[model samples]
Target: MWFRLDLRTLDNPALWEASQNGPVIPIFIWSPNEEDIMPGAASRWWLHHSLEKLGAKLRELGGKLILRSGKSLQNLKSLAKNTGARAVYWNRRYEPLIQKRDDKIEDELKKIGLEVKVFKANLLAEPSEVENKSGLPFKVFTPFWKQCLKQLNTEKPLQPPINFEKRELEPESCNLSELNLKPNHNWAQGLEQEWNPGESNAHLNLKLFINEALKKYTEARNFPDCLGTSRLSPYLRFGEISPKQIWHAIEESGEENWKESQYLTEIGWREFGYHLLYHFPHTISEPLRPAFNRFEWTDNSDHLRAWQQGQTGYPLVDAGMRELWATGWMHNRVRMVVASFLVKHLLIDWRHGAEWFWDTLVDADLASNTQGWQWTAGCGADAAPYFRIFNPVTQSKKFDPAGSYIHRWVPELRGLKPPYLFEPWNAIDIELSAAGIRLGQNYPYPIVDHSKARIRALKAYEKIKK
Candidate 1:
């Protein structure tokens, strides 16, 4: 069975069922140039480690993980031919490019007389199955989520396949070093400190989050400084964890707090995103809301560079962007604020931000990331209203009231009073100097005035309103 991104076996419907058919030869393919398709350097690093762990786990179970590279179809065909394998199996992936690739592979393999099977294992339900009463995909979230709840008759998660007999298949695998992915900065040090790769780590993290953090997640998730979230996004994106395991665990935890509702809703948001991707494949590169195509974005390379490097003179936005650059991850709330700052405040195109996130976020799933950027930019189904631009200073005070998160990521401002840290430009010289704040040195001045930018954004959006 070929595993693309789904690395873990626990609750993996495809992997578990494949073992039932016969002796299973688990496999992973590495494309040297495919790292470009990955979310970012940190994601590639995580993939390398996850693949290593997968190999070890399979070996322990007396099965071997075959590693191959090059064109996925060409590589798989060669492996099948060499082993005289009759069938290939995998969980289905929903991205347009992936769907195209899989279709071609299925046809090629069937013509060669090999049984090809694909299973739905990633999402809670097939995206196409949860349409509205009219059999049309819902563009908005609330109704879609409500429909999803009605359709779910979830089963308990499956245990890891423990009884697999040995199978021998060893083809050349890519040397991890050849992937050419490494952080250009020191940001990923914390990522290494925080995350452990593979299925076992995914389970350990999930259990830990459920046991200690789940109840408080609704409150704590907004603060970047807190351990209020499952931190399972990367694990999920890499397929080191399955959604079914997460679903059942949440169901069993039975927490009756607002946090439970909040976290589950967040998961629902992910489902909503996948649904959009499955139904509207072109939405990846095109705006889901056609009117958004008319919005005029600025061609300000200077502003774009500042935003990318997390130096936009807005502390909260800068901190969030820097955090993403350094660690390849950003808090959910911060994701919204920073995305707003980019598309609304800076007037940059949403695609530019999406591309950067694709290359930087460890948890970058094409469906989720594209949808998220579009949602923030008011170009997606049920997107945040375009004129509802986030004020970074206000967001900072509201979410990180104490400036603890700001101090952590924006350490140069560590000396500032909590009140002024969010907007040091307004501070008296004495206060600024005491806080080690310099107009362009200790902390940057606000790049663009919030009120002015908001007006500009509204005017640009006005063109599309009709």
Candidate 2:
């Protein structure tokens, strides 16, 4: 079984099927260049640990996971010939680059007389599963998700395989450490503190969410300070846990109304992301709505740098970016706020921010990442209007009402109070003195005034509204 993103043994169709057929050799090929966006530093860190855990699990199952680093096709062909393997099996990835490469590899392997099969494991449904009466993909999420609900399979995941014949031939393998996934410098302390990568932990996370947060997910999800979210993105991204597992688990969790559950709707959004990426492959780098291609974006490196480093001067935006830098993940509500600020307030190209996130986020799935940035920039299917700019201050006030999320991340404002926490620039001198915040010195002043920036963004959008 060639494992790319699907890391877990449970509910892994490929692994289960391969085990029943006889000797199964689990091989993981690390070919960075083959991917359109090479796994970023943060993602690589997570992958290293995820692979480690998977290898340990396979050992317990009485088999070894072969590790290789280089071109996937060449490595797979070489390994197949060396081990006399008869079949190749894997779960599919939706990214255009990967889909193209996987297709070629399957054809070549078939030519060499190997039975190749790819299973649908990551997503609840395939990208091509549902469409309108016209046979065109749905651009709007409401109609899209509604259609998806009708086609979803409720079957339970396969029980994890306990035994498989281990390949007798000594398949040449590289040390996982030699893959060089982890950074040389020790900069991942926060990520280490926050996440535990493995299938067991993935299931545990789901259990914890159901116990503590699932009941209040709708109400408290908007408040970044609250632990209302599952924080399962990295697990889901790496396929340590399958969507079917999550979908089934949530169904049994007994929500007030399953169809209207906000959390499940978020999962639907992920499906929508794959739908867009699969149907409109070019949107990975270009705008989905062609008019957005002509939209002018600022090339201000200084502003971009400030946003990247969490020095944006807006409390909510700064907090979210810093949270991401430290933990390799940020609250979902804060994600929209920070993204909106970048595309609207700063007028910087969304791609720059997406690239930074691609390198930084452990949960950065290609379909979701591309869809999110383009959606924020009003350049993708079912995009928010470009004129509907997010006011960082107003968002901070509304969501982080008590300023807890801001203080947790932007510590300089820990001593400040509500109204001032949202807009430090307007704080009285005495209040500012008590908080020990010198706006221009310690905390940054607002990079762009909200009222003025909103107007500027609106005018810019007007140039493309036609």
Candidate 3:
């Protein structure tokens, strides 16, 4: 069984099918050359631990996971020759480059008299399976999701294979350290403290969310201070947990009309992201709407650096960026606010923000990252309107009424209360002194004036509309 993202044994169609055929030889190949965008530092840190956990799980089941590096096809061929394996089975990945690479690998493997079987395990519905009445991929999310709901797979997820067998002589496998997946620097301490990546933990997290947060997910999710959202994105991205597992768990949650719940809609949004990526692959680097290609963007390294370091002087935006740096994740509501501030307030290209998030977020997925940046920048399918710029201070006050979220991240402003905390620059000199804040020294002043920036952004949008 060739494992890529689908790390878990449970509910893994490829692993199940491979086990039924013969003795399974589980292998994970680390071939960064096959990727368009290599996994970032944070993602590699997570992968290192996840692979270790997967190896342990396989050992417990009386099997071993072979680790290899270099070209995927070459490694697979070498292993097939060594083991005399007749077939290769693996789960599918939807990134444009990966899809192309997999197709070529399948063809090469077949030429050598090996059976290649690929199964859909990551996404709830395959991108090719759903389409509009015209038989083309849907551009808008509502109609696309509505179509998906009608043909949603309601089958129970497959259980882990029980009749597992292994070859008498195991092929030589490299050590996990040789893959060099972990960061060279000591920057992963925060990620290690925040996450435990493995199949078992994924299920435990799901259970915890269902018991503690699901009931209030709709309202409480907006507030970063509250544990309202399921912290399951990284798990899903690494394929430690499958959408089918989450779907089945929700169905058995005893909630009436669970299918229409807001939480499920978020899952639908993930599906929508992949749908857009598959149909409009160019959106990864270019805008989906042609007119957005002409949108004016500023080239200011100072402003970009300020936004990245969480030194933008807007408390909410700063807090969100800091939170992402510290935990390798950020709240969904704050993500939109900060992304808008980058593309609109700072007038930087959305691609800049996308690249930064791609490097920083542990849940950094190409499709989701591309879709979100485009949405916030108003340049992709079902994008937010360009005129609707986010005011960081107002968003901070609304979502974090008590300023708890800001206080947790940006501690310099923690001493001040509500109104002043949201915008420290507006606070009186005495208030600033009391809070131990020096505008340009400790806490930064607002990078861009909200009113002027919003007007400037609107005028820029008009240029594109014309």
Candidate 4:
């Protein structure tokens, strides 16, 4: 079994099929060259631990996972030659470059008379399976998801294989440490504290979300202070759990109208992101809407730096950036606020924000990352309108009324009260002194005035509109 993103044992169609054929030689080839964009630091950290967990699980089933690096084709050929393995089976990945590479590999393997099979394991529905009334890929989410809801696979996920017929010849394998997936510095300490990356933990988190947070998800999810959202993105990204498993788990939850639940809609959005990526691959770097190609964006390094370092002086934006830097994750609502601040308030390129998130987020996925940044920047399919610039202070007060979320990540502002907490510059000298704040000293003043920034962004939008 050639493992790429599908890292788990259960519901892994490729692994199950390979096991049924005969003795399984599960191999993971660490070929970064095959990836369109290399996995980021946080992603690599998660992968390192996840691989350890998967190796242990396979060992329990009386099998070993072979680890190899460099060209996938060369490694696979060498392994097949040594083990006398005649067939290759694996799950699929949907990234543009990875898909092309896999197709070429499959063709080459077939030429050598090796039987190759690929199965869909990660997404609930293949991108090719879903379409609009005209039979073209969807540009809008509602109709696309409505179509998907009709055809979504209701089958229960496959159970992990109980029996393992280990091959007698163990091909030479490299140790997991040799992959150097983990970072060299101590930056990953916060990530380790916040996450447990593995198949088992994925299920546990799903169960917790179902029992504790599912009902209140609609309202509570907006508040970053509450643990209202399911923290399962990284797990899904690495294929520790399949979307099919998540869908079935909710089905068995006995929630009334579970299919149309808000939580499921979020899952549908993930599917939608992949759908857009598969159909409109150029949108990975370019805007889906052609006019945005000529949209002028500012090149302010200082503003970009402030937004990245969480020194934007906008409480919510700063808090979210710091949270992402510290924990390798940020609340979804805050992500929009920060992303909008970058593209609209700062007028920096959306690609810059995308690239930064690609490096920082543990759950950073190409399709999702590209879709989200473009959406926030008002450039991709079904994107937020460019005229709708998010006011960071307004969003801060609305979602984080108590300021608890801001306090947690931006502790320097913890002393400020209601109005001033969200916007410290608004505080009177007495209030600022009472709250132990000194604007531009410890806490930063607003980097760009919301009223001014909004007007600037709108004027820029006018250029494209014309």
Alpha-carbon local distance difference test for all models: 0.83, 0.91, 0.93, 0.92
TM-scores vs. true structure, each candidate: 0.95, 0.98, 0.99, 0.99
Clashes of each: 3, 0, 0, 0
Please, what are the lDDT tens digits per residue for candidate 4 over residues 346-438?
A: 999999999999899999999899999999999998999999989888898899998999989988888887878998898889988987888
Give the range where candidate 3 is weakest over 10 consecutive residues by summed lDDT. 161-170
**lDDT (tens digit, per residue) of candidate 3 on 100-177:** 999999999999999999999999899989999999999898898889899997699998875555666779899999
Residue pairs in candidate 4 whose N, alpha carbon or C atoms collide under 3 angstroms: none
How accurate locally is residue 177 in candidate 1, as Cα lDDT from 0 to 100? 52
| Candidate 2 per-residue lDDT over residues 1-466, each given as its tens digit | 9998999999999999988887788999999999988889999999999999999999988888999998898998998888888999999998989999999999999999999999999888798878987999999999999988998886899888765655455689989999999987767888899899999999999999988999998898889999989999999999999989998888889877866789889999999999999999998889998888888899999999999999988999999999999999998889999999999999999999899999999998899999999999998889988878888888988899999999999999998999989999999999999999998999999899899999989888889887
The C-alpha stretches of model 4 lying farther than 4 A from their native spots are: 163-165
Worst-scoring 10-residue span by lDDT in model 4 = 161-170
Top candidate on lDDT is: 3
Worst 10 residues of 2 by lDDT: 161-170
Full-model lDDT, candidate 1: 0.83
Pairs that clash in candidate 3: none
Candidate 2 lDDT: 0.91
**What is residue 266's positional error in candidate 3, in angstroms?**
0.2
